[model samples]
Target: MELKSWFYYLITHSVFNFRLLIDGLNEVPNNRDNLLDTIGLIAESFNKVKICCSSRRERLFEQILQHNPSLRLEDLNYEDIQKHCYRRLHTTRARRYAYLVTEELRNAVNNGDDEVVLKRRLGECPGEMHKLFTSLVERQDKFYAKDPKPYLRLIEVATKRGDNNNHGAGAFLTFFELLVASSAQEEFISRVPKSLDASLLASLDSQAPDLKANVVVRCANLAELVPNRSDLQSYPKEFAYKELVNADSLEVRFIHRRVQDFLTDSEEGAALLRSYNMTEQNAVIRLTIASVTRFLATPYMSRVGKSLKWESLIEAGFWAKNGTGALDIIFPTLQARKPLRMPPFTAEDTSINGKTPPFNVLCPQLSPLENVAFGFATGFAMVAYTEAKLRALDLQKWRLVVGFSSCLCVRAYGLGRESSGFLTMFEPYLSLTSLTQNLTLSYILEPFTDVDFWVFRHLSCVATPRPGFHQSRF
Candidate 1:
């Protein structure tokens, strides 16, 4: 039957023990307003039977419930929680060690009379979700005691896949995407076991297909525990990439949001993660950087790729700015010199000699100085990308410097090495001079030379300046 028919049926059967219960009403992704209005109408019209709805404490949900009387459900009390813990901890006599603390906790709670006394007896029973998750992991400690690497690797994939900063709804990855990223991530984590040594981490081969495949197999085997599937239907169809990922294996993320919070927020969770040495998670960030760079390097880009590139670039910039020395690690890797392609040349005239046709000339490779400049440009661009709004005034300075430097570099290359050396020394002082600060006057003097005009123009291309900045160019 149609939605209207269902509603009508429910409304007619109002007093016949009829009830409507909805969970996660606020989680409706698309047409949330329309859904809310419909629900509100049903709620207002139906007065006899019970109508109960549950939702996260998102602003919209709160706003909808503002005028209505509602009761906030607290976490399970001490005795109830102990019972739950005991159930999870219970096992056969051969595996009896698991129940030792659980039994003790149960007895302790049973002995107490008052709520306060029971709470004291339970003694830090991990009342919150984060603590609860931590307790669950600790319970499994005995099983993973001999080798925690696999377990730690699993947790990392599950937790790190979501937002660590507690912003937004967190990342939602499909099973396949998670599998690929996790495989790569696990390789990095296990490079040098039981250490966060930057040297070992830096030396790790992030490009190993064999290692990734191995990890993927390992993770797949342990799928019941780590990176477990989120509620697939909770997400909207548009939000989910069911077609791109396997239909049979369409998964969302980290069982629930509390699980994400437990991993992201708990001190014990943080320390546990630190023990595994998450410095290697840097590989993922570097990979993200490479993604952006590759897009930028492409000669032609589709509309989707262009939009994605912009997002990737912005994310890379954020990672560099606030990612706790991620930039430091990535910069050296990015700046590391690669062999530059030189123009093909021959030592002697091919027609005159019966000797081998083409002899390789001692062609110039990219100098250390050039590589350093490129690195600096890349780093500065990252900073500019993040601080475009917050530091709009400083961005003007950035534009001038980038544009002028671009011109100088071009001129030096176009002219000769001797000219490059001379300009290199004088460029810094010229930029610092008061004359270049007057952006409007500098444009007016464009007839004299294109140097200043070129600098202004180049900056505009690199970053779209704000309202006032655009006007300053004239």
Candidate 2:
């Protein structure tokens, strides 16, 4: 009562303007009801007194303050957030340009260029963000300038990866993966060490930071190394190669979304591509090859007889899904080998494994290369089939349907799988005349089973003839 009376006196008799602030009201543990009543009384009693409080939206507080003029923190700081982001981006870009200019100045001094000429070159450095990006893309450096294709390819891959909105979207290339990918080309392959060991691991660990720094420079500081969220250690134990290296847990990505935007913007993007003699298809092909090389190089079988073959296949599939004409190049290069065979699962195998193996019940006829190819085919088919179906649905055309379905059938046959189910699903749309006109399909499926041919003949007899059926192959 005395405390209440004191509060009433203070609220009623204060001559100057009074402002009261109670922060973290929800954190109060005792006498909250009385505190609320006091706050309500003070707010309602005097016109001169103003009260402001901060708390999370708890029901107790909401009951009293619901009708009052309240501002959310997000609303209050939205512009501030935008300003902070812009400031950081501007600062990073400014630093990069400064570095580039300094290097150019040093080169000019080495070459003994005239002062006026040097000044003119320095003046070429751009002031605006988009112009800066364009300048960076066009600029020549001593290190990467000789062979900018690899660096530009990396940028293209990163940009495309960002644009994808499907599964595994926004996943950046890990530093180790980037190193492998960047060095996978013929010119750079010799630089990769033949084997991974403790000594090599130490060397790689020491070189990783320098490599990351060099990558940023090569990319005109448009790319950055960020902490990788995926756990490398958790990979299957058969990946002894992983355990051999002290791989950095950092992934490569565009320094900013705006950098990606500048690279992907149609008009600007075309010029950028022309600057490096790069195409989107070529970038995907390079990544697919890189992934395959990495998978083959890493020994997936340990002395304990554990195999990471399935896991490796899945990893290769991830990259192969984006490939364009990759298989044609990849398959012919691989050496032919006998099919791999696995023994039947036993009680001991189940107990030792503690889980069902991924391919324990799989066919024994597929060689290691075939297994990898199957993985590639599976990924390719998933994306291709969806795209074809979407196109067919949008245009309401049977030609597109037959084209994609025929392609899928070829892939299934190549993987040694029956495509009867797939064919049956699109049976209604398959036309006899269209199917007969697809010579590529007929050639590819020439070795297919009698049952498949029978189905084709049956479809031809029952279905309406559709013209302009196109054929595609992997």
Candidate 3:
């Protein structure tokens, strides 16, 4: 019926992605006419249950205020951001970041009294957030540029300018990963390669995403960024630009690698790589420049890894076909505990099949119900004329973001014993153990950008139907 901007689409055939709202309304007509179920599935993708909402933007801010009038709101003012970030950098080239031992951060890891400080201070630090914001801001010219300064601050700018459609949760969540990955452990940096220059370390974040890119991550045993103190040490140029990445110099990569460590076993990092490769039943083999953490970011990738060409699946299956399911399924597919099954779908009842849509046929006698008043609107308020008609239902604009924030509260508290008050307060608000288990997970999931609009209709189950509350696959 209509065609949207091709550039706006990853799947090229749906207007239902809340983020897609910024684009022209060209692609929605077809899906509206041919695939109502697909639209529904896209809407359901916002399900970040720990937040107890799909997180699509509906200006959730006002709505959240209505629910919790006392909820805190950080003013992302440029000056305030600068002040918070000032803590990150030195007044001069030679100033040092108080590299004070952040031990309580780790000590609180298992469940301890120091957990609250870790959650409140370390988790929401102004400096860390600013770095992310700066990276996002610079994205106009240099998103993920071959520099750490750009990466940290670019993400910050993106957050402060929260998207009215999907809110700014995805980028906001990325920060938690940094905190998790980059612990201020005193000893970890002892292993950092001294061959690289300290000044050049800030360039690593931009380098990490490239498939063939070569980068090293470590913490500096003795490193500090002083704005004007170029005299502290004479460093070599070869190691300065691309090789040395650490917390102060290359914050993003340092944080990212820590998260990378959390995802894959530390001991296995080296062994996982070979000129060729080795097979691990649980892990993907044949390591490449592109990390596994990068591959599963999109649904299309998951689908490709799951479904394959006819000849490939058949050709590989003739030997025994016993593990045929695993061979043809999504590569490094997210595992369940003992047995895994694709998400449930409704088995259709063909007896009632007809030209009429399923909802109308479900209750022919009640078909007249479409005329009843449901809200401030006239008749058919809830009666969607087409599946595409079922759209974002927002009583408030920022409600999705606020709802998502609520989920983060649960996760922050639930992950460790820290922030017990916040944890306990928000504990009742959400249970996103599934989503959290996969939180900030770049490759384990199919990236939202790759979802196929037409394929969405194939989903018969509710969004995020986690089978066992306690069991999860990495």
Order the numbered candidates by TM-score, best leading: 2, 1, 3
lDDT for model 1, please: 0.40
Cα TM-score per model: 0.30, 0.41, 0.17
Model 3 residue 14 CA deviation in Å: 76
lDDT of 1 at 155: 38
Model 2 misplaced stretches (Cα beyond 4 Å): 1-129, 135-149, 165-170, 187-210, 232-248, 266-269, 296-354, 357-376, 379-474
lDDT of 2 by residue, 1-474 (tens): 998789778767767788988899988888988888888887887888899999876677888788999988978899998788678757776766555556656656666776568788778877766776676666647556655646655656645654554322234555665665555355323322232234543444455566665776677655666777743534445544442243436667765566766876846645555667755555554554444444334432221011111112223234333232333334323323222323333445532255422221122233344333433333333333333323434332344344434444544453244454444445545533434333223221123344334444554422232222211111
Q: Model 2: clashing residue pairs? A: none
The model with the greatest TM-score is 2
The CA lDDT at 65 in model 1 is 78
TM-score for candidate 3, residues paired by index: 0.17
Q: Point out where model 3 deviates above 4 Å.
A: 1-82, 86-110, 115-255, 258-278, 285-320, 325-474
Residue-level lDDT tens digits of model 3 in 1-474: 234234325343443433432222233434432333333344454432112122222233234323432322243376876677677654632122222224223323533434346667465423432233222223222322223221222222222222222212122212212321222212212212122223223334343344112111111111112222211232234433332222112222223323223223333222222211222211111111011111222222332221122112121213222222222222223331112222121234222222221111111111122211111011111111111111332323122222222233233233344323322332322332222222111111222221221111121111232332111111
lDDT of 1 by residue, 189-282 (tens): 2431233344422222232333333432232222221332542323234423332223213443343445545555778656555554544334
Poorest lDDT segment (10 consecutive residues) of candidate 3: 371-380
